[model samples]
Target: MDEVLADPIDKFISLYQRDHGFNYTLEQMHGKEFGELLPEELLPSLRVYLNQKGFFRDLKVIPGAIETVEKLCEKYEVFIVSAATEFPLSLEDKQAWLADHFPFISWTNIIFCGYKIVDVDIMIDDRARNFNPKIGRHLLFTSPHNVGLTEYERVNNWAEVAEKLL
Candidate 1:
C-alpha cells in the first residue's frame, strides 16, 4: 500500500532533490522499473533514500484514501500487505505510519511480506509486480509509476474506487 495509500515517491523525490540538487518528476519514471530505467549514476545514489530512517514514517496520505478505506473497513475486511522485508528499516516506519494515519486497521491485519503472495479477495497496490492472477482480484491503484499500464483494472483515486467498489 506504499503508493496506493500514501505518496512515498513524493517524499523520496523531495529528499533526493534536497540532497542531490536534481529534481526527478514521478511522471518521468512511469511504466518502468526505477533501478533499471533511471540513470546508472543516479539510481544507486537515490536508492539509498529507501533505506534511510523515517523514509516511510512521514508520508503524505494519498487523497481520498482515508475516507475510502474507512468506508471499506466498515463493510469488508481490510488489511495492509507491504513488501517491508525488502527494506528492513521500513518495517517499523511503515507500522508507525499506519498507526498514525490508519489506526482502525489492527496490527494483526498489517502484513509485512517480501513477496505479494497474499490470499485475499482484493489487492489494491500501485506496483505491477504485485499482481498475480491466482491472488483473486487485483485493483491497480493509479500512481505516476503505474499510470501507463493498462493490463489491470485501474482506480484513478479513492473516489473512483468508492464508486466502483462501494
Candidate 2:
C-alpha cells in the first residue's frame, strides 16, 4: 500500500513540517526510513503520528497507479495486500481509502495482515523482506527507502509497472 500505491512519505513530511516547521524532501530520505532522518527524540513522535486515527486515510495516490492497476485487473486477479495489523487503527482507514481510490477492487480481495504470506505468482512491493525469491517473481517498487536495493527487478513508477505487467 504505502510507497507502492500510496504516498505515505508525503503524509510524514506534511505532519513533520506542520509540527516542527521543518520540511524534508524525498531526496533527503533516500535509502532511509522517515524516522532515520529525524532526531532520536523525534522518532517516538513520528511513531505516534502513524498510530493516530486517519493517518492513512488521505494519502496521495501514486501517479498512474489507479489507471495501471485497473488495467492489470483486466488480465489478472488483483489484490490490495497491505501490512496493516501493526497499526490497528489503519485497517479501517486503509479500507476506506482503497474504496475511494480503487473501487473496482473487491473487498474480498483485500488482505490486511502483519505477514504477507500469500500464494500469488507475482508480488509487487517496496519492501524486499516481503519477497520469497523461491515462491514467485517479485517486482520492487522504487521508493526513497529502497533506492539502494538492487536484488529484484525494479519498477520506478506505475507506468513502468504497466509496461512490464500490462
Candidate 3:
C-alpha cells in the first residue's frame, strides 16, 4: 500500500510490463509504445529521476498503524495477507524485514504469499477484491491512486481501520 504512492511511476511501469510481454529496462523496450504510452528508452532515466527525487522511498506508515495493529492483535487473530511473492525476498528476508520493522508481529503469525485466500477469521489487504467469501471481514486500505475503485469498506488511517475489525 505504501509502495504504491511512494513509487507511482514504478506502478505505471509495472502495469506497462503486465500489459506488454516484456520485462526489461525501459531503454531496452524503447520506441515500442507510441505517444504517452511511454518511450521505452526514457523509462530507465525516468526511474532514475524518481529515485534521485526521493520518490523511491517516501512511503509513510499510516499514523497509529503500530498501535492499532498491536491492539488488534490482542482481540483478534491478526494475520498479514499480502499479495507479494516470496521470490527476490526469501522467507528469511521477509521474516527479517518484518521482524526488524514491524517487531510487534510474531513470526508464526505472519503468512506471506503471491496469492492467498485461507479460511481465517478476517483479512485486511490493499487489493480488497482478492478477499474471499471464506474469510470473515475485509478491510480495504484505500490510497489516493486507488480511491476510484468501487464497493468495499475503505479506510485511509489505521485508527479508523482498527474499528472495523476489533
Best by lDDT: 2
lDDT of 3 by residue, 30-144 (tens): 3232223555565565444333423323334455777787788788777665444534334454455556556788867777676685778666665655788887677676554
Between candidates 2 and 3, the TM-score winner: 2
Which runs of model 1 end up more than 4 angstroms from their true locations?
Answer: 32-38
Note the residue pairs that clash in candidate 1: none
How far residue 57's Cα lies from its native spot in candidate 3, in Å, is 10
lDDT per residue (tens digit) for residues 121-145 in model 2: 9999999999985656899999989
- Pick by lDDT: 2 or 3, better one: 2
In every candidate, how many clashes are there? Answer: 0, 0, 1
lDDT of 2: 0.93
Ranking by TM-score: 2, 1, 3
lDDT (Cα atoms) of all candidates against the true structure = 0.83, 0.93, 0.56
Q: Write the per-residue lDDT of candidate 1 for residues 9-100, one digit (tens) a residue.
A: 78766866787776778766676545544567877765588888788889999999899999999888998899889889988999999999
Q: Tell how far residue 159 is off in model 3, in angstroms.
A: 1.3
Clashing pairs in 2: none
